[model samples]
Target: MAIVELLNQDMKQAMKARDKETLSVIRMVKASMQNEAIKLQKDALSEEEELTVLARELKQRKDSLHEFEEAGREDLVSKLNTEIEIIQAYMPEQLSDEELETIVVQTIEEVQAQSKKDMGKVMSALMPKVKGKAEGSRVNQLVQKNLS
Candidate 1:
């Protein structure tokens, strides 16, 4: 099923199960997707576009999670963790380190990226292939490791 339909189905199940956290997270994601569609002036988002929205949402929560941890806000940290899990459930399966490294190396080769200076070229060629499957930072790190 398309992500939107899957989300709708999951939202109904969450409502039926009285899963407040899941329901809230689903609503938030749905709203984000809707907002993105409006911003693009599209009636619906393509699958890639949907993944972009999910990625943005996941990244925001993860960034917040890090800040909360640094601030020693345990309560908020736990809450954000839950939210992160909920958001991640809707994302594509993540790439393992080995797989991500392989792709990064291949992209670097494909782009003829010889050093960190070519990082932008490698990333531009790499991201679309690995989108929704790997975290951008992790990919960047792998690229750097292989480059230098």
Candidate 2:
């Protein structure tokens, strides 16, 4: 099923199951997707666009989760973790560390990236291929590790 249709179905299920947290996340994601569509001058989201929105939501939750963790706010950290899980369900399967490293290596070789100076060259080529699959920060780290 398409993402929009799956989201609607899940929204109904969440309501029936009284999963408030899930319902809230779903609603927020649906709203964000709609807003993205409007920004692109469209009436609906494509599969790729839906993935982009989900990835963005996941990134935001991760950033918040880090802050909450740093402040020792275990309660908020747990809630954000749940929200991140919910958002991740709608995203493409994440690239494993090994898998991510393999791609990073390939990109480095392809771009002949010899040092940190070539970071941008490797990343520009690799990100589009890994976008929504891998984390940008992690990819950058791997690229640096491989280059130096």
Candidate 3:
């Protein structure tokens, strides 16, 4: 099923199950997908674009989770973690650290990225391959670690 349609079905299930956390997350994701479609001047997004939207949503929650952790707010942290888990259910299978490392190494060699100066070149080439499957910060860190 198209991601949007799947989301609608899940939303109904969440409502029936009285799962507030899941329902809220799904609603936010659907809204984000719609806003992205509007920005692109399209009625609907391709699966690739839907994955991008889901990745963005996951990133936002992760960043918030980090801040909550820093603030020492366990209550909020737990809630954000739950939100992250709900969002993650819709994302592509994440690349393992080893897999991501191998890809980063290959990309570095392919781009002849000798040093940090070529970070952007390597990243532009790498991001498309990793996209929704890996976190950008993790990929960038691996790239930097390999380059340096």
Candidate 4:
């Protein structure tokens, strides 16, 4: 199902269940997606575009979670963690480290990446392949490890 459609169904379920947290997160994601579609002058987002938006939301929650942890705001930290979990439900299954490493190695070889200097080239060529399935930072670390 499209992310928006899935969100709508979940939103209804949350409302029925009185799940305020899930409802709030779903609304946020829906609004974000609608705003992105409007900004891009499209009636709707492609699956990849939807994935991008979902990924952005997940990243934002994670960043906030980290900051909250550093600030010792345990209350907000738990909330952010729940938000992260909600957002993650819509994301593609994450790649395992070993699977990601194999892909990274293949990409490095394909790009003929000789050293860390070719980092840009490797990443540019690699990201689209992994896209929503892998985090960029993890991919970067793997690339660096393979290159050096």
- The model with the greatest lDDT is 4
User: How large is the C-alpha RMSD of every model relative to the true structure?
Assistant: 1.0, 1.5, 1.5, 0.8
Per-model TM-score on C-alpha atoms: 0.95, 0.91, 0.91, 0.97
How far off is residue 69 in model 2, in Å?
2.2
Local distance difference test, candidate 1: 0.93
Runs in model 1 lying further than 4 Å from the true structure: none
Tens-place lDDT digits, model 1, residues 30-130: 99999999999999999999999999999999999999999999999999999999989889999999898888888888888888999999989999999
Candidates 1 and 2 compared by lDDT, better number:
1
Rank all candidate structures by their TM-score, best first, as comma-separated numbers: 4, 1, 3, 2
| Model 1 TM-score, 2 decimals | 0.95
Model 4 ranges off by over 4 Å: none
Estimate, for each residue in 38-132, the C-alpha lDDT of model 3 and write its tens digit: 99999989999999999888888889999989999999999989988988888889999999999999999999988899999999999999989
Error of 3 at 122 (Å): 0.6
lDDT, candidate 4, equals: 0.95
- For 24-136, candidate 2 gives per-residue lDDT tens digits of 99999999999999999999888888888988989899999999999999999999999999888877888999999999998898988889999899999999898889888
Q: Sum up the clashes in candidate 1.
A: 0
Tell me the tens digit of each residue's lDDT in model 4 across 57-121.
Answer: 99998998999999999999999989999998899999999999999999999999999999999
**Pairs clashing in candidate 1?**
none
lDDT of 2: 0.92
